[model samples]
Target chain A: MHDERMISFMFDTNLTKHLAELSKINFTDDEIAVISNEMSEIISLMDTVTEYNIDETFASADPVQFSDLRKDEIKDSFPREEILKNAKGKSDTCFKVPKVV
Target chain B: MNDLLKCTVKELSNKLNKKQISAVELTDAYLKRINEVDGKVNSYITVCNEQARISAEKAQKIIDAGSANALTGIPMSIKDNICTKDIRTTCASKMLEDFNPIYNATVINRLNDNNIVMLGKTNMDEFAMGGSSQTSFFGGVKNPYNTECVTGGSSGGSAASVAANLCAASLGSDTGGSVRQPAAFCGVTGLKPTYGAVSRYGLIAFASSLDQIGPVARSAEDCGIILSAIAGRDENDGTIKNIDKADYCSKIGMSMKGIRIGIPKEFFGDGIDSEVRQAVMNAAKEYEKMGCILEEVTMPSLKYAVASYYLISSAEAASNLSRFDGIKYGYRSENGNTYEEIIKNTRHEGFGAEVKRRIMLGNYALSSGYYDAYYNKAVKIRGKIKAEYDEIFKTCDCILTPTAPSVAYKIGALENDPVKMYSADICTVTVNIAGLPAISTPCGYSSNNMPIGMSIVGNSLREATIIAVADAFEKQFETKEASI
Candidate 1:
């Protein structure tokens, strides 16, 4: 149902820029073309969701509810050294981050 | 005996209990097998030869003390995504190539408690993203049955290792059929328990709502043995249900009489290969001959399952994967000066094409203007689909369908075509969306001698029923084991 012109239009619109900014990843022009074509195809397939009219009260699937939560109690946590083992920039006892203005 | 590698978990346990074969011997046999065929199969990312030997020694002591558990001496592989303390848990991505978790996943803790010997970490689709193992930065996992074909993924390596006798059983995380489809392609039995059935505390998140850690083994009984050890309420994972421990192994030989099996009409429609359809239909017939009832059920929302699954899973993935920046625990980029630029460059260089495409799609759907149109609508439709399944379950105990639309395609058959790759998950994704338990067991073989799998889906937490039906059906077929 989607045409090439519309696909290009969707790509040219803020869609590409917004996605790049949102995901914090840049793409080449050719990459954009390929991604745009794929996105357009996926969007057309996803259009089927719009065909069904869901009730306003319809709730998403929640197999386990929070009411099943165990009583909150003080418990042991992972050791501090172990927790910081994967930190890229870390001091002896704290994680180091970039300076903010 | 070198043939000990081909025995089931039960057989291995019995042999260990009788002192016929020591755990060290079994571990050595599997290690030898890995050294032999892993060059062509490439099922393992890391072979824990030394660790397995140590565990096997400990297990031999346990057996000597007369305290051997069902899987005490069993040598198995863990999917690379599962964190094992001091061992690298690369999700087959360059991002975490050097990263090692300080703690083991909760399932790993249980396996250790049972004295199960771990052979190694199996390869997988990078961050469990792709349908075929081709997306792994390590390399594609080949099908044991046909070396030219792919082992369906992202749990392809786990299934392949089990099929090729690289290990007795293995654990894999299923998010959108990662466990089931690959098990089918490799002719192994794989179960994806209910979303909260197994604790997900230490699993590297891939669509957390749908992710579950389950077992892949030679038979449903082995899956049950592994599941019993792993399934229970964990205080660390609040999503775990507080139910009594299920005796999954006891349900294997149970009668299938008077059980109702629903065959979804939509699952057999267009896009399914005629061979797969025939095989699944033949499985249903076998169930009927075992005195089970087969009813054709209609779930119209299934037509939208692939779309809904992609949207919802990608949205969750976008949020879940946001933590993997250059700041913590993964690949860092030296090309950028600023923090933001460094993060962006790191992600761009580290992620595979499929991962990047999914992140882009997810961000696009969750972007400001499109959230309501794409993500929200997809969630609503997901609710409708779940509701339809709920209604169907009232009339039937479980549902049956082909695990995948076709047998394993060639290694590069769908490399360039991403949408077609997503379509291959059509028959298996609905169970994940519904948060139900399902098992993929080899039902028959295709004309090419590749294995065909059928999925037996049950309602939430109904793993016992699903496994029982799968065991019954699998026993009816004389499926050819893959000879590597």
Candidate 2:
């Protein structure tokens, strides 16, 4: 069912590579083919949006507009212990990530 | 009574208030039902039996002290995506399988303040992503009405639990019809409140702009009761509207005389099952008999709504889900030595196929060259759709449509086809895109005995009118229960 050639032809190679890297999710060759085909179908569906003549002056819908800003008073914050409860790796009240250097 | 679990929230509340039934007893009945039936329905991912019993005992004390609210002592379920302090909120994904939040969602706090008993977390589509609960990591939730059929999704477990009498009511988030679709399929009542009505403080972010937590219950009036407790401004959630909460339950019994309902012709067009169309049209006629005015309205932008919704939601999802790296609080991969490798390996191992596909599509749309063509255009169309809905509301108080294109489909029916599954959301997604309030109530049952839901959509913040109309219709029709 996998069509590597078709997937390579459907999407721009560099764009696909960049997307794969950005998402940071590995896909097998077959999964890549399936994703590419599905993505092509979705993009074609999305192309219908271009056919509608949207007024240039119309702003996108903002469901709620923030007007009054709350006073920037120091409020109660989550306890550090609670905040770090779900951390995968922590050291001395700080999140420990893989060494960059 | 052994059948106490079958009572509506309102009925149970009355009984609790009258001291006829203790909250502990009510919770015990529901727990027993869950233990007996949930194996077949798979509505709950984690049953908090001991915790619920403890909460019930507290609720009983509150009732004895004569400080009970309408929801006090009621056993209700929360969707897995909504964070509950110290309770595992997985979003039905392996990524968050071991994650437990230190804080509760704003709605959970509200429920707690009202003395509602928590009946543990219900199952849902992972990250509230799929239309069918089939995408859940905990396994697909079966429709209470027919175990073989799907419970319409993302909130499938929420609706199924309510319909099957597993709980008095449940809370489910609707990004694009996650609540209402499942409610329709499961023969229950569900509401997707107007955007900004319910604060989204701790809901696992799927699409921030589209996500609104609402109630799922057996009746529209019950939904209103739950909404009144949870709907309000939250300083934590800046998107919440700064307005006083309306008395939603109070408006339920109001007269429907002269209320104008707009029926969009496009909603009834091709691909709608004949049974669903007939049922909704019959509901429209029922409204006419009740002295409500019905008019056919044109919404030319309906054709582009699904396309626009998918693009916008996926784009937002791509950005929102970027935080789930291996370093944070979720499933981490041991196979990778480098940071990038760890993140990639973790994501690959953690996310399911549908979720990964959406993420890829989202990243693809927002990619450097394709942003203007896809994301920008979709946003513009969304604006137009919202404007059109606003214009239509000037003449009509509410719009009526079928909640879903058809009744609950058989499991694995559309599982292989993503486009077909996407198309299943056609009737409901537009409401989310426009940020309106909509309710799904059981209008009738299909020939196969599956429920058909009719959606009543109101303009933003018009939940009172929507609930009033739904309650009236529910009273008049009295649709059959799921009979699990």
Candidate 3:
């Protein structure tokens, strides 16, 4: 839906400048406008929810646990031909390694 | 067959056991109904005639042996969001329009094990984001109750399929009222089982913590049957644990005496349609008549639920959806210079506008500088929302409210006004955010013959309690026909 509603976004370059320094990700003037527009929509959507008084017993959201199926067992390996067939680059039964250095 | 479509699961199961109808005959009847009405309604994304026929044949063999599974030969539609191995499981997004899942979701696997006939995959908001079902990459789903109005979002197709009698039941996912809201709008019964009560393995994640797969059908009893088959500890999802598995039908239709029902005051506030309010109060009156104690409970965090929920859910959405970068699977852009170009170009074209907007907003919220301010704070607020529910449950066994603020709106009414449409989910989102079990059942009709739904939420792991209260209400309107 229309981003909930528009909020007045302060054009503070402090956040822009800080993000630039922190992540080195670039944000153009157009990108800022889009972000501002989106944040405003979020503000509008957030307005419709109810936050009435609740008793002290309830927790907001609880993390329910399921038994972990992750195992430490060894997996069955693909045969030479099968593994080689899937490799984009390979050398004898092994996937080729790209040099990072 | 039209009369049969109106019966509850217990009624239908009893008749089937008595050999009053054959599985093949029932499947053919529903298939016929689907062919006749589905062209205009657009509920299904794919119709699995070949597979359903094969399964129906097998069910006939089992019946001859005098043995049958709980869901033996029953036709059911799946919301496109859940992955079904070998079936084209499109999440109603063009990105995966050609994608075929390699494995079935836990729920899909359960349905297969129970010998249920797989009718087809139904439509949804592209990747389950919008409230109107208008954002579905395939097309919009119409409310079976009123063709002019929308079947509420994400799970709209599943709800409509059952409402139109194309399927005896269907499975849907709820991140924020996707199942319950549509069930309300389409005049059916839907249950969003307690967090971890149902396995989510292979269900395409949309805010993994909030998303749940549940049943959308004609009766709460049907929802119970489907929920029982699909729930329990799975080797896949680790978030679900300590849940006591039981047959929900066994607990349903029981007297509500000693069942403490709480009516959340916030849900009855301004903007709720007078008719829907009257309908819910009427259901509450029925509860009181059944000797259930009704009390008004307060949940203050509900006020910020929409805000916190959007921030966190979208933040999760952006990360969960990043998997469709073209390189792995799905549509790949032919003309991109580098790997980056391929990823960006493919995504820019594959996803619809609504999906892109949510992704960008989510990515922005969780980005380096704003992570704590938005995503992190939202998580903390979530903790508080859970605390509130825990407190209320001690005083009441269940909480009741109108599923949506109003009945289905005209198809285009909220299409362009995205915020207005998102606000339509206000009553239902808090349950998802708080990770509680909730259900929506038809309460009454609006003046225009549109359907209204009443929701009953219970403590986590209390799906049976919700269904019992819902069944009690269903008894009052058991024979009411769709005004359409």
Candidate 4:
């Protein structure tokens, strides 16, 4: 826990390229280094939770109960114009896309 | 009445009934306090003064006519994660920094139904990830006591606001001690009820299976009262059932004669600071004097709690956050080629680094090759953890441990280490993983006078018994006072 290099261990970039690809956000190596540094601090602060004597009495994930989530029934639908007003990009009566379309 | 703003809901309700203080005046007083102190704490993200004034005006009429609800005009703050219809529901992240929910969360609806004076929304960790409240896009919340030490988080702002008397009681979401841990840092009582005891209809998803909303207040009684109003079944939250809610304030000052409490040996070992452990031991002795019997219990599988919790929570967080494609209300990059392009651009631009890390970890854990070993194995181990708790419950009514290994550290204590920060949840995450009830009540203070909490847990849906044990313990301790 006392190693000075432990601080640098957080920015290992082990997951950087992979995560960037998945999340679609590209990160400069400097940005990755910064994120890793901050992450290391957060991880160290949370080290306390790992010390518990959970003694096999751990619980499972919460179970799903009866959800009133209704089927996708469109009621009182808003006009496309109103909804698209807040959209970053839109096309003729629908959302616009880049050349890939 | 300067004292009116400090009174608990129980006290305020009694005074309101006796006409010693009017609800409208009480509401105005808290609004004034928020105005005076909000700048220092950065606790509130929004102030619903218009709705508060309107609610207070109506409460005055009800009181004048001699008919009003118990919580009428009682000021309460809410976490930023809960939606309030057109009000900013930032989750303290720049991602949805300006996105507004089209509807209110059921808990918000329930509180409104009780006529609670909406004080405003409190800040939290960005997307409820960070523990020190440092991750908020709005800025970090300072501890009311010193402003140098952190107010433990992701619910840090709610705990700080309540500790500082900016509001009577505030509601916070606890995925894993989010409410209770912060309560300890700020010297307040926080309850994370049994997973399904309170509805999660409006809470923004972190790990949907783990998040539960609860109350943070100055006393166990206050937490109970707020819990009573906020508990019960909600059709909107399908995961919740039609369970009966007990009168939370009904059992206060009650005898703890036959209650059997188990003290887990693992919580008090070498890593816990001496002062923090001493505070908990002192609390245990105090509980012993309160006519309850204490027994030693051990759950050996808990050593892996941190490893198990991270695998599952991070995995779930990744899946839940997948819905935030830039196509929606959140930040979206201008890049759009294929459908995949929009997702990558939006997520890359919208989510911060920590979030991206978790999402990638989750995607990998749940990925084809790693699913069985990482995710499935963790789930199986989770069952073992649950089994151990189940075995112990057969012998005792509840369990007790330190809410955190120690008191709040400086702002940057673990800012460089994500895993270390995640480990802080080790002592508290078991209860969340188990889907049980737990509370963090102020037990004692550190040499520096920072608050320490005693975590009390009980069986599934056993809110009544859990609060009863905590109530008995809280009543006997005088150091339970908040530093502010």
Winner by lDDT: 2
Question: Ranking under lDDT, best-scoring first?
Answer: 2, 1, 3, 4
Give the residue spans of candidate 1 off by over 4 A. A1-9, A55-57
- TM-score of the A chain in candidate 4: the value is 0.60
Name the candidate, 1 or 4, with the larger DockQ value.
Answer: 1
Span of 10 residues, lowest total lDDT, candidate 4 chain B: B475-484
Task: Residues B283-402, candidate 4: write the lDDT tens digits.
Answer: 888878877789999977677677677777778898789778766466677666677877776777777766776776666557664465456666666777777799899999889899
True contacts kept of each: 0.54, 0.65, 0.26, 0.33
* Tens-digit lDDT track of model 2 for B357-442: 78888887787766776788888888888888988999999999999999999999988788778878899999999889999999
Better of 3 and 4 by lDDT: 3
The count of backbone overlaps in candidate 1 is 0
Candidate 2: C-alpha RMSD after superposition: 3.0
Q: After superposing candidate 3, which stretches have Cα over 4 Å from the reference?
A: A1-8, A11-39, A44-61, A64-71, A75-101, B478-480
TM-score of structure candidate 4: 0.89
Model 1 per-residue lDDT tens digits across residues A1-101: 43322332365425765686788776666877777777777676666666666775546565544327777888888798887788777888886656644
Query: Stretches of candidate 4 above 4 Å error?
Result: A1-15, A32-86, A90-100, B334-342, B479-484
The predicted structure with the larger lDDT, 1 or 2, is: 2
Q: Which scores better on TM-score, 1 or 3?
A: 1
For residue B374, what is the lDDT in candidate 3?
A: 62
Model 3, range B59-165, lDDT digits (tens) per residue? 77776677876788788899998988778888998888877776688888888888888889998899999887889889999887778889998899998998888
lDDT of 1 by residue, B396-435 (tens): 9999999999999998999998878888889988888888
